[model samples]
Target: MDIKELQAERTGIFRDVYSNKIPKRVPVNLSLTLEFTAGFGNLNMAEAQWNLSLLEDAADKLCQTFYSDSCPFGGSMRYPSYYQTLQSQSFIMGSNGFIQHPEVVGMDVEDYDYLIEKPFDCIVERIIPRQY
Candidate 1:
């Protein structure tokens, strides 16, 4: 089938499923991760997200290799440069180019009162400052 036909069929599947109707067949939805796409294209995870052209080429190759009714290009999920620039301890990239989220406790038990008193302020000032 042509591209338009393929799109329509995919949309129909989602539409029917969301409408609480049984589709002609099960919807085979797929989700890709940044690391997976980077490895698939032999690209640096950090660079892939920063460079749109690289991501586009990799995405094209990725879709060609993997058959999925629906898949969002994974590298768009995170921009390592942004996180790197921010010096974020929450999300860090390793030598292998994979971003890892380390376990971090932004608030202590003693801070619970402050957190409860000002939820948004606690999150933005206390928690987020600690994270980024």
Candidate 2:
């Protein structure tokens, strides 16, 4: 069934369960990334990301055969950028793939007064969204 049909079928069951009624089958949400979730099953990263239909086929077989109801969702992994400049710090990965913390370079601001008075455009360009 499609998502709408599935939702219509399961919504009443979920509402009853929320009201302390026993559900025929418990729900599960496996919030795992495509890469990390490959560890659980016999799927490779490419298979999980590039070929989602195949991944779902494999999941369906595994779930039905093993009586498993686990569902996995893709997660994101963001990598930090590198900056090597006079007024900026940088991070580098070693040959063994070990990353070192960022090292501080020269002072970015010489005077607090000038920095505080600088216009918005004069500030460093925003690369990432601000998180709460």
Candidate 3:
């Protein structure tokens, strides 16, 4: 379904749930976003593929390498990105293998100069091999 249809369905389901009415169908919230991790630096198909694979592997194992500031039970359900730093305040791994820092990017950088001083840690140590 498209965005409009999805939005309408979500609104309807939310209203129904709030009103204690049984929804016609069960609502499943599959929220996903895109994350931009690593770049191949303008390489050919073969080289690009190699770099892309490496980035994907790095992103896949991000959660195991770093710990978020908040606990799982906390209100924050943030997921760490593949190219994120361990000290990042908030991060998420996008569906398209992109590492996103929505909170930081959306904030006023002038007010939050601390972010500039402490950028997220780029995990290059665990990246995939180009040969693969």
Candidate 4:
């Protein structure tokens, strides 16, 4: 079948599931990680993260190879531009190019009163600044 026909059949499977109807078979939605894609495409994980199009291409190739019902490209990996724009300090890229989230205690143990009194402020002024 053509790409369009394949895509249509894939969509129909998902639509059936969402609409609470029995599909011809169970739709397999694959959750892919950047490491897997990078390895699959023989790409450096850092380069793949920076070059989102490369990741997209790899994901498409993977879906086609595996005959996946659906594979959400970049669903598990955020664009590097987003982190750059936000000046994010929370997420760290490892030497091997894997993204890591370090544990952070954003609030003091005694900060419960502040959280109760001003939840939005706690999130915006206190928690976010401390965490990110």
Among these predictions, the greatest lDDT belongs to 1
User: Whose lDDT is higher: candidate 2's or candidate 3's?
Assistant: 2
Residue 88 accuracy (lDDT) in model 3: 52
lDDT of 4 by residue, 1-132 (tens): 998997898899889999999998888887777778877888888888777667777777876687557774434555666766776667777677777776768889777899999999878988888765
Which residue pairs in candidate 1 have backbone atoms (N, alpha carbon, C) closer than 3 angstroms, thus clashing? none
TM-score of each: 0.82, 0.35, 0.24, 0.80
Query: Once superposed on the true structure, which residue ranges of model 1 sit more than 4 Å away at CA?
Result: none
lDDT of 1 by residue, 31-57 (tens): 787667777788877676566577667
> Which lDDT tens digits does candidate 3 get at residues 5-123?
86687788867877999987666543222122232222232232234454444343442343432111111133443234454534445554333455443333352444455434211
Clashing pairs in 3: 35-98, 35-99, 36-98, 36-99, 85-121
Model 1 scores a C-alpha lDDT of: 0.80
**What is the lDDT for 75 in model 2?**
43
Error of 1 at 104 (Å): 2.5
lDDT scores in order? 0.80, 0.46, 0.40, 0.76
**In model 4, what is the error at residue 82, expressed in angstroms?**
2.0
CA lDDT, candidate 3, residue 12: 87
Return the clash pairs for model 2, or none.
none
Best by TM-score: 1
Error of 3 at 8 (Å): 0.5
Error of 1 at 40 (Å): 0.7
